[model samples]
Target: MIEVIDEFYSAALAQETIRGMIENARGGYRNGGLPVYGYQNVRSTDGNGNQKTRYEINEAEARIVRLIFELYAKGNGLKNILMHLNDHGHRARSGGLWNKATIASIVRNEAYIGWTIFNKKDTKIYGIQFKPRTEWVIIKNTHPPIVAEQLFNRVQALIEERHPTRTAARTTASTYLLSGLMTCDRCGSSYGVTGYGRGKKYAYYNCLTYSKKGKQVCPGHSIRADELDAMVIAKVRERLFSEFNIRQLLNDLNVATRTVKDGRCEQVKDLKRRLADKEARLLRQYEAIESGKIDLSLIGDRLRALKAEQNALREELANFERETMLAPPVITRAIIERYRQEMEQVFIGENVQEQRAFLKNFIEKVVVGESETRIVYYAGGIRIPSGIFPATSEHPRP
Candidate 1:
């Protein structure tokens, strides 16, 4: 404990020292030996003959960078840009042909707009960790910009539009869709599929926390996968096609739109306005410092605090947008019938992964206990007996 505390304090001190240096460095480039592609270093000697490196635009490479941003902003995909550059005999900084990933990196770089960001990543126990935007150190107009600020902002907007936040894991061919959906009733831990018996033909869902951490954490909660899956499918099919449930869902959506959605839209608008205000304030501070109306030292703490607030606002704004975009669909009778038919076909004829995905759409969670299993559907839940099949010698629990 003492050693860990000492190490933590040391790290904190190091981070603070670096932050101070960056705030005071006053638009000087501080590369940790990584070469930036489009810029050449400009060396300067201090009064004491100590040398420092700064950045200046390399026109030839800067032209290529400009072309990349232009192509991307004009609706060219990364692959198209890559092939265009490579086909024209253009090469990367490493003297290799351009690739899709390289084009993506160039497009995402803020250095093209004369902005330098620090503390974007840190070394962690597992690997390099990308730190949140709140923790980043940003220096604006640090050097000559290849792209206009308006163009850069537009590019960033396009990137965000293309990639939205995900609430669930991406589906893969081999992944069992329902693997992480079940939980242990006792300990509220995820249940994993375990295979047992000769040749491991039988699959059961068991509490992973209990298996790995012993009974101190959770008791054993196990159930055969086939029986549970069948029960779940039956329950979903019964509830989904019912006219009463469909009407209730539509009524709930109407209520949400009337009461919740208006308030949420107003909140989102307020956040956006505040974000714009903060950005404008940052720009004013920069202008003040450049015009000698305010000292750089005086504004350091304020700038960091403003940036942190802006980052937080951006996160909240993203959440609100996600909630708005992924709002519950307004289900009409026709839509419900079509959905029911598709679901039935998928459950009967599709693969296990597809069936699991179908289940996830409506079922929020499944909790397994000793004698009963509770399934919480998106609209509601139902409790059923654990063992749906008669116990036999071949299917005995461990």
Candidate 2:
């Protein structure tokens, strides 16, 4: 009796399971046997000579590409283009506002040149995608190019040219003369200027790194507007009076620079020799790989290190050429005369910016400590240290 009951229950369960399977199959057929918002059927050939489904450019995307190229050709940088589009009430295809990331994407994309690039990004551990340049597969002239190859290359060059070297924020109005010139004596970083109040405001110059990083990183030293002007004027006068000392400094600099010329030439030759040796080694390694005596994988690591060394040597050689071989004679009398004329104008100048500019041209780095401020002036390649002034002293306002 128990066996019979168990058989009956099993039969019922099997029938129900079959019914559910049939319903699922029918539903799947009705739904086209694919996910809603499924990936579009893309006709593309893979590296392994197999057809693969991938996203292709649409008409709207092609128009955007053309627009980007046109904007780039007009000397509008990526940021400016993005800002202009946003300001003009232009929306992206996704109906979203333009952003830096989107602008960068449009600028960097090479697909506008009729090439199809794949595998720009891949999934790494559990749903995390990483984009690697090395893994990109490029198919040349896959579609009609919206932008010409030459035009695209020029746009790319322009983009790279506009990339900022430093992160110093630039103001629309040029105010300070020594805005970008002043450097911190302690860390050798540029000084940033800030102002307080409205018209007839008090402006101060402080080390940028220290201001941003706080006093724990660097002791914040400041030179007030009036104090700096007086100090610079006094130093100029002092240097003018000591004519003999000024001439001696210039003569010494000239002699020292000339003496080092032969050494600089020898250094350049040595660097060239080292670079040649690396190139020969790289060539030999390539030959070994071709001959099946060495593994090609090891060559990459060796070449990277060798290339870095060669680059360093080349930089040193360049520096030697610039400093020793190309250094002009530093005439102290001429410098003094120039400084005196500038200083006189600076003292009476109505425009603060002009005054600051004159001072900046002569002063290299002004080190303001707790007690004294030391100003270093660079004439040609030689550095002349001017008189130290008390940091607490007051003077006429700009």
Candidate 3:
């Protein structure tokens, strides 16, 4: 019991001494006088001397703290910003490496926001250490802010956006050729690429919804990567070489306007009816407001909603009428010739990026069905369908 009391007194004395030294240094620095700097090298008669590491808040070190705070505000998460600093050979305050915990501490420190909190955690005698937020002593405006409060809040928001509590692992790279251009005809969902087995062993593209869950959600429709590639190459070759297929595509596109004209006319009429109904509602709201039948607040809200609906309807009606009246001319032999020449250039292009660009420009989507696969081509402001059978000899080609 006596020894324990002695040790406690010694610790208390040491802490007091350190506090007095820090206060003296701070006062001397404030008064434009030299601080006591030789304490680190002060030797005692005991072992190893008092060789300790001391830190002084020099202008260069302060500048580094400011730089770190600025980086945190610029839409970079703590981990990434720390990595960038470390990569550029920036060392931490203790001349040590940077880690996630250190970066997190720097971000959460209120000192950067021009405030300091002391005694956040405390220990009394031999009892367990305890810290209550309400007991913390906060000193406001203790230091200059390195980043604005608004910018810091935005950085926090971005951090939360990137790291949600529950998130699925992002699998594929964004540069896949068929990424947004393929769909399942049965479920009308997009197809996704998946890999199987271990490293360099196996990989394939399957219906994403089915692969992640089960076949009950979707029938497991899949095509081998190599097989799909070959099919697309063959189709491209055939389309380029075969004169008959090229002519048929052009003729079909030409005839589409005449065949869909009646349907287009009905669509325009329907849009006009919708526009008239919306306009009638808007006029009714105006009359109610004019006569003071409704409160001004309620009338204003209703008027705004009605006006928006009427504007949308008017826009739709105008679009329908324009499309009906100004349909592109029917695909002709000359048009076919020009398309063939363009396609040939794409087919024989040495650059992969150019080929993918051409394919994306012409093809909207390729829908894979159980029995038939349909390629939707974007031509003359319409999606022209080209049918292919997976069971048959014909393969996919762009």
Candidate 4:
């Protein structure tokens, strides 16, 4: 019986998804996913007050996309293009640092050439499987193309030529604790390490743009790697793990966590009931017309109007359910104490790779200036003056 019900539910879901896909294609709207990097989902109402959603270009992100294409077309390697973007302090649509995979995805996507492609993959009980090119449903001229067709074509060809075998490269794990998390305030690019010495490393975090593109692009912002890391470690110890700060952090986290409200829960239930009632009433009215108890012509417009209302109510119910279902993280005194005891050791004792992971969990980004580096934590951020840490530290060496 359970298996039968599971099969039925899957069938129903597949049908609904197909309906949604067709509607989205006809309406030229984003088909229920994260808005692509250079686009945003715009929700509005149609002439008869029917809800509609469409993908519109985000000019800021679009400009970055164009720059990527331009640079690639001008014969820059993938890594060089990535460096160029990071050097300029440009972030990916997701607001993280630029990477080769992201650059490759943008270069390969046909959407930039004004196409909405779907059904390129199939999801079944096992998992997702890629569909053949023949099965893909592509709608052309869905919106304004960010890149010209010629330019897009050229980039695609270049990508194919550059990686003919399409083999994935094994990336060496980063040893710098804050490699990608740190940003250069002067030129907006991510900071990278350079200048090693005789068995004694002289690593420093310098603007990637200045390191590669030259001082013409950025004034060569830099900080000694050891000094910066020590400062960050000290600040983390001072701000996050301090007794007063831990209590405050816990309080803030507790507040930020979401809770479902009774009002919203009630609203969801009410909307569902109303939708069912409205559908039943409309069905009976149609039946009456079919049975000749009511004139079809007289109630045709009313039936259409009622159906539209049903769709609107369904949308409203979905929105309510989504918002009410989010639950916040719970922090306790015990957890705080455990974290306080372990954080210092984790930051100081862990190898560079492990330290990087730890930093990502708490630090959002580090903006480095000439005199001060603003350490942006995931919770918020704190600024500390540069050149303040000792040349060395009691912290365990990696």
**Candidate maximizing TM-score:** 1
Indicate which candidate wins on lDDT.
4
Which 10-residue window of candidate 4 scores lowest in summed lDDT? Answer: 389-398
**Cα-based lDDT for every prediction:** 0.73, 0.58, 0.58, 0.75
Q: Rank the candidates by TM-score, best first.
A: 1, 4, 3, 2
Q: Which has the higher TM-score value, candidate number 1 or candidate number 4? A: 1
Per-prediction CA RMSD (Å)? 27.6, 24.4, 21.9, 21.8
Tens digits of per-residue lDDT, candidate 2, 142-236, equal: 44556789988888887666656544333312465455655676777677553322342455666665544334345556665455655555675
Q: Tens digit of lDDT per residue, candidate 3, span 252-352?
A: 88678687887889988888888788888877777787898967686677778888887887888788788888866777788778877887777656555
Tens digits of lDDT, candidate 1, 305-325: 999999999999999988866
Comparing 1 with 3 on TM-score, the higher-scoring candidate is 1
Once model 2 is optimally superposed onto the true structure by TM-score, how far is the C-alpha of residue 11 displaced, in angstroms?
62
Predicted structure 4: lDDT: 0.75
Per-candidate clashes come to: 0, 0, 4, 2
What is the per-residue lDDT of model 4 for residues 1-398, given as tens digits with 9 covering 90 to 100? 99999999999998899777766666676666787778888897766787877878899999998999999988876656776787688877667667666777788788887898877767753654657889888788877799999999888787776663775432222676778888888778888674332343456567766555444456655566777887887787677678898889788767655333657778899999999999999989988988899998898899999999999999999999988887544789888788777877777885887778877887899998877889998777899887573222111111
Off by over 4 Å in 2: 1-174, 195-200, 241-343, 346-348, 352-357, 379-398
